[model samples]
Target: MLLVPAAHAQGPAPALPTAKPRPPAPAQPAADPAYEAARAAFEALPEAQRRAIQDSLVWTGDYNAVTAGTFGRRTYEGIVGWQRRQGVEPTGILTVRDRPALDAAGEAVRKSLRFTVQADPASGAVIGVPEKLLARKSPLPRGTRWQSTDGRVTLDTTSSPPGGTDLDALFERATAVTPERKVTYKVRKPDFLVVTGETPTGRFYIRHAAGADGIRGFTMSYDKTLTAEVDRLVIAVANSFSPFPNAAPAPEATPSATLSPGGARPGAGAPAPFAPPPLPGSVARPVATGLALGNGRVLTAAAALETCPSPLIGGAPARLTLRDPTGALALLEGGQHAQGAQPPAIRVEAPASGEALVVLGAEAKGAAVAPGTAGAGSVFAPLQPGAGGAPVLDRSGRLVGLVARFPATPRLIAGVMPPTSHALVPAGTIAAFLAQAGVAPGELAPAHPQGASLGAAAAPVLGSVVAISCGR
Candidate 1:
């Protein structure tokens, strides 16, 4: 699990496609009645048949025709030739009788790519995939992932974040791709967003929609040379795509390595009086901030768990519990004593964009608090390293969010670029995470406008926050 902002970040899978959506166009002038009618009738045909018609026209030497489902001047001229070839009078329009023959001809062209329908029970995404080309498939964080053996094609399905994702955020991620010669097309309706473009790597298509079930969509990419055939295959996948209840079993809990009175040992029932081994080189053992909830439950950033074999809170060993695979939240158990006295009364409250807030676990002298502001899904605090799991509080000391590092655009200083800044997981995300874990938070109300000094406001909550350390 990763702790980056779920609203903007793609799911946990490393190879999944990211999208940057484009702006919607303004309303256009009304079209001629006759042209509009013909366009509508053309669009009414199956997308496959329309594309097939377009390809047939191109194959028959109508090089100016684009396969898009529209009946423009070039397309009309191409249809005339097709009509003449079918022994019908050249009306420059296709009729019901001509649809089948067009499809049959299109099918003949697509036969070179043997396609098969594959059902992903885990994510409930059933799509027509080119089994002959892509022989490897795997399950991803929120969907299924597939790739061709030769690495030419890739496909993925994605699920929306917990509190729902803003369409603008989704659009921004999709359009970030770059190439010297790039072309993009975007469509935004009341319910869904589609972004497709050609980058240096390949032709990419991304679709995102928020329905009653949640935000769900798919992405596909192929070598530029495979555009025509790949277009047909993806159309079939889109038409058949659907989601059902996720039926995969939950993963078993990971055992926390326990420390003995003598020394350190792996798991339970082990002899003591030995030093613990170092954590694997792959995982980073960074110091992080942690928040104390009641009943030995502590909440922190998921990034902190990436390599910590045994995570420590206030010098006491803590147990790993539930974590959100799609966002930056993790729930821990058995560390209430680390907070000193009773766990501080923590409450959830949403803060305004520029609300006066203090970050508790930030590296500061004495009772000092690092000042910051609330962003869309995170906080904008210039926190020191190791503040990943700190608590964010309002002037009155109510919990507003958890401090976590999130992806930010890089900035250049002198001649080199610096890393993105850290942010807080907003209260809305905290609420959704705890709700899923069946933990009810205490009543929290917005604080009154305040004028207290930073130290005075932060002192009360500082005692309840602790720095987390990790080891093998």
Candidate 2:
């Protein structure tokens, strides 16, 4: 039986009743020439300069960097911008500070471009492609059982290894340093899709190293075999590991930064959908309910808005704006903080970044906003729009640490996808599944089987699954 996701079960919804969904938009027909050109330059560049060059690429997929960027896979503009920030003239472009100290630091980042998968950097583990898993040509049959050594395959590592890479080496390396994490198989194009109120969580990934633009719009459907293959992986992995307990946060679904008031003009090739971040010690006037920030903006907790005890809703309608001390609104967007509340958020980054800022929770409106807030030592109030959470801002007016992780309440049960005895999905695992499914991994929406008892805490066994490994 197919499981359909209720709008709420998928994610936080907007305030407007007829708000449209935000995924499966049509992708630009042509966006691949970048790779070929970059590849040539990469092969010609010295090893020292190569990593810097690869890092400069603005491709959409992660694994694509592992593949295409190895040869060439970044946009010239994005690379130039990254290099300029790195303090290298490459071709003698822009420079921030001529101080030797800053120059040396920028050079170090350029030099440290390993472009390789980090092996649980703390644990000394290496993540890489599973040769055997990639060698398979045909799809596995439905109901095919795979043995798992890890009993917690559904939620954590409750499931054992399937025909993918054994993460022992990666795990051991990162064992003491970072939390244990392993990269596994993914569907190049996934069949199963998890549609939420705003975005669709598709369970697969397709690598694209050199991309000049963001994945604004795209769509796909899976064949039966591919669909089943992708399903098997999701059942076994995806959101499996709770690195920070309840840390399966997705990117915010909104638009951000474009024009600023008072003549602070946008840079060349300004991105569509923009929202600058708040300057230090300043706040944005919450307009039209919410705001966005960051080049690739961040979003605050909207679903948590309703928690505000005395939410004030009566006001003349206005263009929603995300602000900082400097005060620059990116775009006019719609957001729903809660039924009766409002959580103001905005993006400051460029649309070209192909990044999203979705926060799980924040400091209460009464507290102070910080540079970032994802770990311990932070007090987050229940995210009720306008009630409060930590403040997030990018250098230019970007809000990075956004999103509200409201406590598990009757209305927010779907917002929390606990690892079950049957399924566990992680970010990296989802990437692999997307690769296998033959679709862009992050492009797909969240997927869950219909009638599946999500209430079960632990994950299941003997089925493929995705698992996230967090630092214990």
Of the candidates shown, which would achieve the greatest lDDT relative to the real structure? Answer: 1
Off by over 4 Å in 2: 1-40, 46-75, 86-159, 162-186, 189-472
Q: lDDT by residue for model 2 over 158-240, one digit each (tens)?
A: 11122221222222222222122221211100101122110122222211100111111111122233343333232112211
RMSD of 2: 22.8
RMSD of each: 22.7, 22.8
lDDT of 1 by residue, 3-25 (tens): 00011122332221232232243
Residue 37 CA error for candidate 1 (Å)?
Answer: 11
lDDT of each: 0.53, 0.23
TM-score against native, each model: 0.36, 0.18
What's the residue-level lDDT of 292 in candidate 2? Answer: 21
* Model 1 stretches with alpha carbons more than 4 Å out: 1-81, 84-89, 93-97, 109-119, 161-166, 177-183, 232-472
